[model samples]
Target: MIHWRVSLSWILVWSCSLLVGIAILCFGYFDNMLSHFQQLEPSKIEHVTQAAAKQETLPRLHSSKTGLALESQAQKEKVPNKATLTYKDFPSPVQGKILRGIGNCYLAAIESYMFHPGEDFLEPEGTVIRATHRGKVIFAGHDPLLGEKVVLDCSQGWIVTYGCLENIWVKTGENVEKQEMLGQVGFNPGAEGINDQPQLHYEVRHGNTIQNIETGGSNL
Candidate 1:
């Protein structure tokens, strides 16, 4: 019994010594860390804080730049081209009355003979004539039969012909938009005869097929 009691006392002493050593080690470690922090200058502290703030802001800056780049690319793609036009995107070529309708039973300008292939518009002399739709000019010159004429290939197998125009501004192979002025109304002496009235011979075609504007059969 005496031996067991002596062994217990020794064990208790060892445990107490271990706990005290651990406490001293913990206190010494904390004291060293505190001293290191206290030794730093104000400038060093400010620099460390600023560096941490910059690190936090970097991700947001990168995200904003990426977003702006994506938006710019989308805007570029959204830009329209000639192929963007639909068949019905055209407006009237001239603001005037339809002097001769489209069909076979129409008066020939130079003579009293019937059978006209296209519609005719009568306007005052020098009136502005505009493009029916966006297209590229394929012919811009005087035709012996049509007078001063401008022909445009408006895409989708469609073509527009403007006759009896003066002061032609667009040349062949030039791109034109809807309602853009191509020339001014001019006299068709053959059609007007002694009266000398200003007139525009407008025609729309789809793959060699002529379309009637009033009947909506012209493929627009």
Candidate 2:
């Protein structure tokens, strides 16, 4: 029994020593980690922070440049073109009453629905047709339905068309002044059967868009 008591005493002392050694090892490891963190230089930390800040601001810089470019383009669009005409520059092709106006319209003579793309002026055959605006005669040719047609490219982006003409005085590529005689009114027997009367079909266009003769042509 004395021998067992002695052995128990030794075991207890060994366990206590082992626990104390483990505690010392844990404390030493923590101290080393703390010292490593303390060794970081202030300048190095500042550099890292500045790099992170630059990364955050890079996208904002690009957005600002894009906004500036868009604003410049908008300003350019607001300014009018020097070659373009104004409201006062436009004039009528003939002095006559309006027979058929622009847009979808019904004609009694044709007895069918049609989309009239221009204004028809009631005029007698052989009435002198004049230029509506100062322009270059881009086309003076024959149309299948409009008979003899004349197209003028005026200042800016405006174009004028004179249809159902009996004759064309000006040739293609000829430059003409406003009110210059272009042709005489005629009947488009192929398409225009309205009342069998001679009339002038006038059309104005910008780009690919057809414009109204009453408002759009006047308010060039």
Candidate 3:
């Protein structure tokens, strides 16, 4: 009876060992499956991140292209306007003119000396001065040396200045037509009371650069 009980206890011990080995094998299989799933999850996340990065990059490239296209369109739309002044039929404002060919002859020297950009027409005092072209008055003011000055900005990059005037009749930014009276020529400040000869010191500028006005005037 003692030998039979000992054999039953050995059989129960063997059965428990077999169950524990099967449980260990099953646990190892489940752990391998979890590791493979984790590796696949990282690959999926990398693919999603690449797709999102492509989406963001494409929009930025498209926006840059659109901006360049808009800038090109703006460049194409720009156009230069017509010239307001013509080389014919413009009359001299002052009568009994003593400064004939003053713009043609003496302007080059005056420009060199004072770095002045325009011509000087020495006429009698109170000579009526006219606008050279149809334009807007940009400035109408007085300087101590220049006396009364009138500046007109015409079309096609042309600007005309009338200086050494006794009085100014126009205001700044006023639209002025061609041959309109700007002001009367006055005495030079240095020759005030010594000599009363009225003269109009005129200047023509092309986009802030002074040019010879004789090239544009009609010979009377």
Query: Taking the tens digit of each residue's C-alpha lDDT, what string does model 3 give over 52-123?
Result: 999999999999999999999888788565545543323334444434333333223133323334455677
Give the Cα error of residue 104 in candidate 3, in Å.
15
Error of 3 at 68 (Å): 30
Which should have the higher lDDT, number 2 or number 3?
2
**TM-score of candidate 2 to 2 decimals:** 0.56
Task: State the local distance difference test value for candidate 2.
Answer: 0.82
lDDT of model 3 at position 168? 84
Question: Residue 136: error of model 2 in Å?
Answer: 1.3
Residues 1-220 of candidate 1: C-alpha lDDT, one tens digit per residue = 9999999999999999999999999999999999999899999999999999999999999999999999999999999764554335554666687877665552356446655657778788888888878789999998875689899998788888998888999999999988889999888786522256788888887786777776666532
If scored against the real structure, what TM-score would every candidate get?
Answer: 0.56, 0.56, 0.48
Ranking by lDDT: 2, 1, 3
lDDT of each: 0.80, 0.82, 0.69
Model 2: worst 10 consecutive residues (lDDT sum)? 211-220
Candidate 3 Cα errors over 4 Å, as ranges:
1-113, 191-196, 215-220
lDDT of 2 at 70: 99
